[model samples]
Target: MAASSWPVKIYNSSSITTDSLKVPLHAFIRAYDAPTPSIVVRADTQVFLDSLAFQDDGKVLGFDLDHDGYDRLRNTEVRYLIDVYMPTRSLASLRAMGSGDVVVTPSALQNTSVVLTTAGSGTVFVSAPSIELANLNISVSGSGGFQWDVPATKVTSGVDLSVSGSGTLALSTTTLDAGSLKMAVAGSGKAYVGASSLVNVSSSVATSVAGSGQVNLYAAGTCRDHKVSISGSGDAFVSAMNCRDTSAVIAGSGSAYIQSTTTLATSVAGSGRIYVAGTVPGGLPGSYTPMASPPVTTYNAVPVPAYEPHKTKFGSHVSTGTSWTRDNATLIGVLVAVLIVLLVAFGVYRCRKSGRACFRSKTERPVGYARKTSTENQAPSMA
Candidate 1:
């Protein structure tokens, strides 16, 4: 279909590919289950489609913005709202080849896998309620930023997130129960993974920050077998309730703070600092460097008043004045001793009052008794 023939308006056109797309500045790209898979690019202003192709068993869609036999729309200040529709039983894959901001929400996708790459100041937002994918791979090598609002059940399989060329990436999720999660930041970029509950990495998690980049990860629950590497003045901070058998390597003046792990192994070099909490099996190895401790303050103590003892009308001795300390163990021992003495004295008094010995000799019997043999008292037996 031509760009003008669509149900939307059109502006000036430039000669590029034979197809033209007219879409508004702000539009909605929706995907729904249909009898046949089709793509409709509706724009407020007319735009040309340089190239569009479907490959990979009709499961992939690739589009390029071209004008005047040249790909100028990608580098120009033009934005379009893209909507994709797929079949009920088909899984679609999207590849964005332009340098623009791409925002993906859960409502905009069903069963899909995404691969996004841009070399401009682009921004990609993945804010979804629930996202289930085979894999997720995102690479941004510009001064752009990528923000991912992970849902409660996020990332079924593996996730590869990378940001270079001073780009920034942020991920927020309640739980990341994936097979594996790998994140890397280089060229002065920054990356953050914030988990509200626990970042349950079923397989492994590896993070690297180099070239003055920074990476911070926080998990409220246990993280199993995580590895972190920082070099070239980069800083990495990781904190979890308990981390089992974790490792960290810091080189070239980089720093790492791993807090509250059941077991940790650290290797540091070049004036790097590795701060670990909990237990380190054989202590830190290699050029082990400890973090600096905070300063302590001193305070003056107050004097306590002396204690005074008095006897009440009920004949119970108690402390009459303030400032008294009671030794619990000593008090308990004394009470037990007094209880034993009282019990013995009461027994003796009872024996004296009753005029009977409290204990009898071993040879004495309780009452009068006489021993009789069988022959002494014999009864007449029938012959």
Candidate 2:
């Protein structure tokens, strides 16, 4: 489908080279090659423009978010889109802080180490298949979703994923070939990992509410070691069929599932249980539905709604507003001419009846009437 085109406001035009960029507003960032780095922001109101900031240096570019300033534009029809142009190298990291959905383009990353952080009530879509990072770190700490679907991503060192608050970090279908993988979840958050072969995998979940913090690990191949810790009502599901060794500790009513072929070292407290896969009473938790990755977005201009022109309290006038026109002046002149003709005709009629000349002169007069002297024309003395 063709992308819509909306009006754009270039907030930051001067290009600066930067490897790390931060977007703190509701904007879409697309990466393109250019001589220097630039940021293009499109917004309906000046509020977003007023709160925009850029770094003078060429290393790090930051956009500061003003809470009160952004809130004033919350209920209005304010849309934001940002275009980012970098050098030939890829953007190394990104930090987004907003409640506005932002979609990152795939060509935005070509680095060995990339770190992405998201906060606020917005969702960030990262679906770059060509991304190959040595170290990948993702952290989410708000009521939002961080959808990372880089299945072909290869991690040489480690991979870290964490979720707090009522957020989710979904990477279920993503395959990672890493040395070690670490996952953590707290509060009412959730985490999902793909079935990948790893040397070491560690996961921990702490939750106070029922069906809260949950972690699901799907390792189809060989795993050197797997470790898990659960507390409160949290649960962990590990599907490593050929794991060499496993260690797990559960407290409260939590549960852990390890399908290892070698040794198992576990500690349980209260009603916690350690079971194998498909051995549960009924089935896995009904609430453990996999989170699907959001569709990739094409950075096209969004359509803006049409609105009527502004009107004044005096009402709208199609003609030349409150000023008079040449047509009005011509009409007024015609009326004055007709009025003068009528007054002259009336004076002639009155003169015939009174038997006097309407225009007074010193010598000229009517044929039957005598000429009026200066004394007669003037009024008598007041005395």
Q: Which portions of model 1 show Cα errors greater than 4 Å?
A: 1-29, 35-37, 44-59, 67-81, 88-92, 105-118, 219-221, 278-383
Model 2 local distance difference test score: 0.52
**Which lDDT tens digits does candidate 1 get at residues 1-383?**
44345443222212122111211112223335454444545432354333222222233333433223133333343223344434443433333322334444345444445554434444555666666776767665556556667656556777787766566666667776677778887656666666777777667778777667666666454556778887656766554424566788765556665643455677754445666544454564543334333111111111111111111111122221111232233234434543543464456556657877544322422221232111111111110
Q: Candidate 2's residue-wise lDDT over 1-383, tens digit each?
A: 11125444454435455677766544455676665566765554566557555654566666553444445545454445566555555677777664545567757764677787776555667766546567788877666667766656666767788776666666633455665677777655666665444323332222121234666555453456667776555666554433666566654556565644455566654445555532322333321112112111111112221211111121122121122443344335434543543454455557646877544322322222221111111111110
Say which candidate scores most in TM-score: 2
Worst 10 residues of 2 by lDDT: 374-383
Q: How much is 322 displaced in model 2, in angstroms?
A: 48
